[model samples]
Target chain A: MSKLAHMFLLLFAMAGITYLIRMLPLVFFRKKIKSRYIRSLLFYIPYAVLSAMTFPFILYSTGNFSAAIVGTAVALIAAAFRLSLIIVAVLSCAAVFVAVLIL
Target chain B: MEQSPLKFKHGIKDGLPIGLGYLSVAFAFGVQASILGLPALFSTLISMTNLTSAGQLAGITIIAALGSVAEIMLVQLVINSRYFLMGVSLSQKADATFTTGKRFIAAAFITDEIFAVAISKRQAINFKYFIGLAVLPYIGWTIGTVLGAFSGDILPANLQAALGIALYAMFIAIIFPPAVKALNICFTVFSAALLSCACYYIPFIRNNLSEGFAIIICALVSAAVAAAIFPVKEKDNE
Candidate 1:
């Protein structure tokens, strides 16, 4: 197959898998999912997901330890102050880029 | 609270800010997809179907890395597992009087931002507002992807780099509100950053892990540690 055709097939399969994961709980667990403990656990999932998503980016800019340290410091300060999302992210990226340049 | 026919109105109102924010991020994804050599139509289609920021980024990265179908599926499953919890949380906020059709529609639109706003209302989520919230963001995401894919071809490389800032900005926005008063949140975020950096520097660990998996591990570990040390007291049922 051509490269385009290959990409199409891969994306199609990926979409199918993604949709199934997202839809399964709503469909299969509709009637079976009635518990308070599970509900409480669900509340924490977003926080967990968000933290996981942000962690790596703040560390290891361009796969370097020093840049990661600088980036982490900047992100922590911005996050602590509750700065705007755009500001913190931009600051972190800039900090990392500058740190890599200097160190 | 008084019942209003403008239920969907509220959703639209709440969704507008989020939708605006989504436009830039989704546009970046579109550009990335195009740069990766995916067709413009395919890029837009992915955005329309998925409507997720991190998931789309992961999907594009995995595809670019030439991961096998099995690997892609596993990644998607793991990355999106959190949605199951979100869906269940949404169910509690939903009205028992709502029909299956309504639930399905609402479930389809249960994004992180939408869920946060809906849950904060502490009322039976109005289907109208839910639909309203979904509408603009959906359109913005689809259109942004298409536009970005097309524009990626013509945009200067420097401009593209600047546009990339939008995604990070959105993350900062989400973290800012929660961290304002909470030192523990700050510490947890910092710790996760440190851990992620260590994982990156360690050749064996870095080679074994994908970004999605790393994110899940870091977030859960940091948050779990923070929750243990700084527990929130719950109100007793009267």
Candidate 2:
């Protein structure tokens, strides 16, 4: 298959699943979903998913591993204070940019 | 209630920060996706259709690794499934002004940030407010992708390389604030990381399990274990 077609097929599958996930609950649930286990599961998914995705890969995302580490450390510190997302992102980028330059 | 122009404007105002934030993050996504050899046009298309950073990025991995259809579907289901809860939570916020059809339309743009704003609104949301709330961020994401995609040609190599770190930084900014607030969450995230690190290094597991599957396993197990150990505060779940 052509690469574009392959990409489109993959993206289409993703879009369909996500849209269903987002739309189903709103359409079906008039009352709040009261299942505590499900609720807790939902509550923790974002943190867990983002954590799994970010780390390990973050160490390898930059041009240099050391640069990625420095950038990630700076970002965590910025986020610890609940700073704006943009500020944290820029700070992390700048940290990596400088780290790569120096090392 | 009538479709109020004032409410729509307020929604737009509320969406401004989200739009600005998406512009930067989606710009990072664009650069990252393009760096991975994805065409700029498809990157923009992903943003336009998905409006999610992690899901789209993970999907890119699946595509890059030539993951199968079942793998792609399952991974997206696991990663994007949290929106199901958000949708249920936001349904209560929809006012009588919304019709059945409008509800479906509104759900199309029910994103994390958009839902946060909509749910926090003092008044029940109408279709107009939801539209204004979702439109700007949607545009910002797509436009940022376009800029990042094309900017690859213009940006010097060093700067482009630095921009790659933006995705990691952005993810850190997202998870850190919440992780710090809750001890169990701290444990959950770390455990998930450790598990993936093992998967990345363990040749038997690493060779057999794709990145998408590894992510699905790590996410479900970590969240489930955390929930069992530290069930969310009852009040906060409401």
Candidate 3:
């Protein structure tokens, strides 16, 4: 295969695999889960998953420890107030920028 | 399931910040594609099709290295597997109005940010609101990819680096509010954080485990433990 065709082939494979992973459960698993244990577990998955992804990773995300720390602190405070997602994200990014400049 | 008063308009409004965040991250991806001698069109196409950051990066690396088609599929499956869990969770969150066709359409756009926002809704999301929520971020990601491919390094390094934290901050925002009100949720989040830290720090696990698997392990273990300890008496249909 030519280079461009090869790239397209690879892209399609990636897209196909990803779409399958996302699409299957929603399409087939429409019934409400019966078990309280399972339902509660699902409820907690989002928080648990997001939390794991954020910390330690967030510390290294900005490539500067102090900036990331500042950003995280601002995000925690802003989130505690139940601020909108936009505001909290913007505040975090802005805090990281200012921290980067000063430190 | 409680009927959500939210409509397409609310989705658009909620999606704006997510779109803004995607733009910066997609821009970085675009620049990486450009560095690999790929054109702006290709990078934009990848963003349009995949709509994911880490998966796209891994895909392109495999492509550049002349890896096989099987390698592409396997790597993407491993990296993007989190979407499987998210899909299962969101499937339960969707209202009756979220039919087969709507689920099919909405499933294509289930990124981490989009899933987080959708799951955070107090009521079950219907198809219209979910689609409305998805539009802007999709466009923003595509546009950002094109811009990055064409105008590489226009933004200052500090600003771009700062933007890197935007998605994580949004994640924090999503997980924190409910945490304060419920002690169980607080414990779950804290436990997941500790487990994740262990995955990051322990040399054996750090070296052996991929980022994607580490997330799955931490989330599943913490959530299962929490559920066993504090099972909800009734499922909150909200």
CA lDDT, every model vs. true structure: 0.65, 0.83, 0.82
The true-versus-predicted C-alpha distance at residue B237 of model 3, in Å, is 4.7
Measured by DockQ, the strongest candidate is 2
- Where is model 3 more than 4 Å wrong at Cα? A1-14, B1-43, B51-103, B109-137, B144-152, B233-238
TM-score of each: 0.76, 0.95, 0.70
* Residue A11 displacement (Å), model 3: 5.7
Error of 1 at B122 (Å): 4.5
> What's the true lDDT of residue B34 in model 1?
70
Off by over 4 Å in 2: B1-6
Top-scoring candidate (lDDT): 2
Residue A66, candidate 3: alpha-carbon lDDT? 90
Runs of candidate 1 exceeding 4 Å displacement: A1-6, A9-48, A55-83, A86-103, B176-180, B220-238
**Pairs in clash, predicted candidate 3:** none
lDDT of 1 by residue, B1-238 (tens): 4454437677777788878767766787787677667778888878877878767776776777666676667656656666776665566666654467666556656577776777677567756767887888888788889888899778765454444434544555566566555675666656766776776778998999876566657656665676666554332100
Give the better candidate number (2 or 3) by TM-score: 2
Model 3 residue B128 lDDT score: 86
> TM-score of the B chain in model 1?
0.82
In candidate 2, residue A75 scores what lDDT? Answer: 90
* lDDT (tens digit, per residue) of candidate 3 on A14-97: 899999989998898655567788767766776787788787888987889999999999999999999987789889989999
Itemize residue pairs with steric clashes in candidate 2: none
The native-contact fraction of candidate 1 is: 0.34
